[model samples]
Target: MGLRQDLRRGIRLVKDVMRNRKAQGKLAEALAAQPPLEPHHYRVGVYFADGKVNLYQMRQWYKPLAELSKRHPVLVLSRASGAALAMLRESPLPVAYVRRVVDLERVIHEQDLHVVFYVNQNAKNFQMMRYGRRWHVFINHGESDKMYMTTNQFKAYDYALIAGDAARARLEKVLWDYDFDKRAIPIGRPQADHYSGTLPYTPDERTVVLYAPTWEGDRGAAAYGSIASHGVALVTALLATGRHRVVYRPHPRSGVVDHEYGVANRAIIDAIAAVNAADPGARHVYDDGPELGWQLSAADVAIVDISAMVYDRLAAGKPLLITRPANPAAVIDTSGYLGACEWLNAAPDPATGADAGASMLARVSEVAEDPEARARLGYWVERYFGDTTPGATTARFHDAIDHLMAEWERFAALHADDEEVDDHDEEGEADEDELG
Candidate 1:
């Protein structure tokens, strides 16, 4: 039995390697025929290495990154050709596919990039860190209490554009001697300010409930995803309330780690379909699209897992319910938002013995009219995201980038000779050597 399991694991690894090779090969062909990057001194760059695996991360920055591009020459520098093509194909942001380290070296020297922003903690990013006279910033995909948020990896980046004070506190507790003021900049949630996309259903009077759960995590501590445990039951209860419009948006990579979880996810989606088919006016939606804003902005109340979706809905200042992870090993940080959050536990909690269905319906009914419940949302919103008025968060985001650019200019001037000349000069020499 162990031998069979090992064989299966080996087969999956081989398939993954083959897919990567194919993607790289296709990328090489495209790179050979592709045009030179749009000639401009890119002040800011978004560094991405993973192809398709972390595509959702890029989508989070799409609107805000595009807006930044208009002011400064913002370019998406992808280490994988396939990643570049994917971004260019789906998003309008200009992308440069750099398979070779020297190619990236040329971009840094030629563009005179002042700052480079990273979406995820990809190990390949360390290659870019070797370059000097530029600031390396970590702008994570979203705000969450998941272990990834408090990783030692945060120490590597020169700066991090965090959502608010909650992130600073989380990092301080985990990392010793970490400079929160200098290293962390509170930009709020820029995506919250740019939430767009048309609502699937018309806004007559139905209350929209968005069930956005995280993917089944890769390991035990991170296994905060509640799709298999709470999804079917919670979604069923919401749909049974005929007046509610259910917008089911599972994490893009949901069930990738667990087969049983995947099966359960499909079951929930099918259940929504069945409901829609039986009642055309139900307006039940199973959202798996690239768009994110519409659901958050449109939904009257949201039910989400203990991931980035939690803070995202909090930024919306709307009523929300967080699912208590069925896995006992999953870590729940109760310092800030999660402490104040209402939980929907499948198993009876000592304090709230009500089952998941009863708890969900009761909260939904209460939030619809309770002014104090809505006011409580406001207090948490201020704590997680300060000053969430129209355009406020986006302004702070731009200001943070501007601050980095200004600081880079001063630092670059003072340390002009610190810039690496060997890599850039070698690239030019190599071209001449080829010509000779």
Candidate 2:
């Protein structure tokens, strides 16, 4: 890793330490004052809520559980995810919001939860599920190629939901080798169900092209160009059409803590801001989460680099485009400085379009207007969504939560009301807030 990457990892580690310390302290106090009861008979707690819609693939797996709420009182866990879920509830579904993982655990024990479901497990999320909750269910985030994932991911849920047979096969192939066969369920993405149901009150009318770039990393947008370069090279050509709405959606990590200034790289973010403000057809949308159906609804096609938006766009079977640079040997990464646009489509560069001003509009326009080209893209979407049965696959994702809830019950039965002394080896104050 580069120095900046090393520093970033260090900073994240420091934050993790602080989180655990605070939660541990609270756990001790709660143990000392709680009642002992068998957890086999407890409520179920589901940890999820909606994120932004433009980010399609990453909605916290809450919508499907909407079905589960009819049978039981479901506890929805989140930080600001609650706000996103308000509209989703539509005046139904008994929901409780716990802002942190520690809060979830405490609530799980107190409520005697029978199962706990976790969807979208990234590196940090994996660390959050170590509570030995009796049964854990997982709804996986899929990959581009339907193949086995690295074993460290969340295949350990009592069951899992996959988008389709291909997704199931891919998930099973990767996980069973690690003995997670008994813990997976092949199902579809529930959020996909979300879009079909209701249209928001005031939807943007123009062909909304959601331009979401991944965060800065070894191979992310920050390396290529600031918001300006991407805007000029990719977004601008389309905006010049004066008939499209280009939504500049950056990765969820593009927050104040990520960049030096709250704004993205000055050159690029400034360009995007200017373009968005200047053109009625373009505007940048900041994320609260990766829930992006509203934006996706407005889109005729989604243009992305190596972001999940590509796969999510396929969920809608909408037209999608991925950018590739003309040159293969023009990529770079530095310690703290933003890198260069090295993330090119490695295939021999296509001569159909140019990355400069006018050429982009021509090539993209041809693709947008061509029904055959779009059909080819739809084929790609089918390959990605893989799930033929939506309800079944959604259950697979919820299965994990049920198991986790069950585990919480067993844990409460075993570790009720007991005191333990501290054996700390760190010196930072508690930061339990970030767990959401």
Task: Give all candidates' CA lDDT scores.
Answer: 0.81, 0.49
User: Model 2 segments beyond 4 Å from truth?
Assistant: 1-42, 47-59, 77-105, 120-133, 141-151, 172-181, 196-206, 218-229, 255-291, 325-355, 387-436
Compare the candidates by TM-score and give the number of the best one. 1
**What TM-scores do the predictions have?**
0.89, 0.62
lDDT of 1 by residue, 1-436 (tens): 6787578678877887777777666666766776776555678888887767568889889998888878777888887655666676677677776666777777776686788999999877887877777899999999988889999999999999998978888888999888888989998999988888887887868888889999989988889888899888778788888888889999977876786788889998999999999999888999988878989988888889999999888888877888889999998899878887877676533467777776766766776667777788888888878889989998998898888888988877788786455544343323210000
lDDT of 2 at 260: 38
Per residue, candidate 2 scores C-alpha lDDT tens digits across 1-436 of 4798678778977875676556546544544453543343345554553332212432434456566665555554443232324423332334443445554455555674555556555343443355553455565444433112334465455555445544544555445454434455444556665654233323465566666665443333224322334444565456566666566666655432444322534444556567667863444443344355665656676666544455566666666666553223424222111122112232322575444556655555665677875666544455545553456445654564455455566776787775533322132123233331
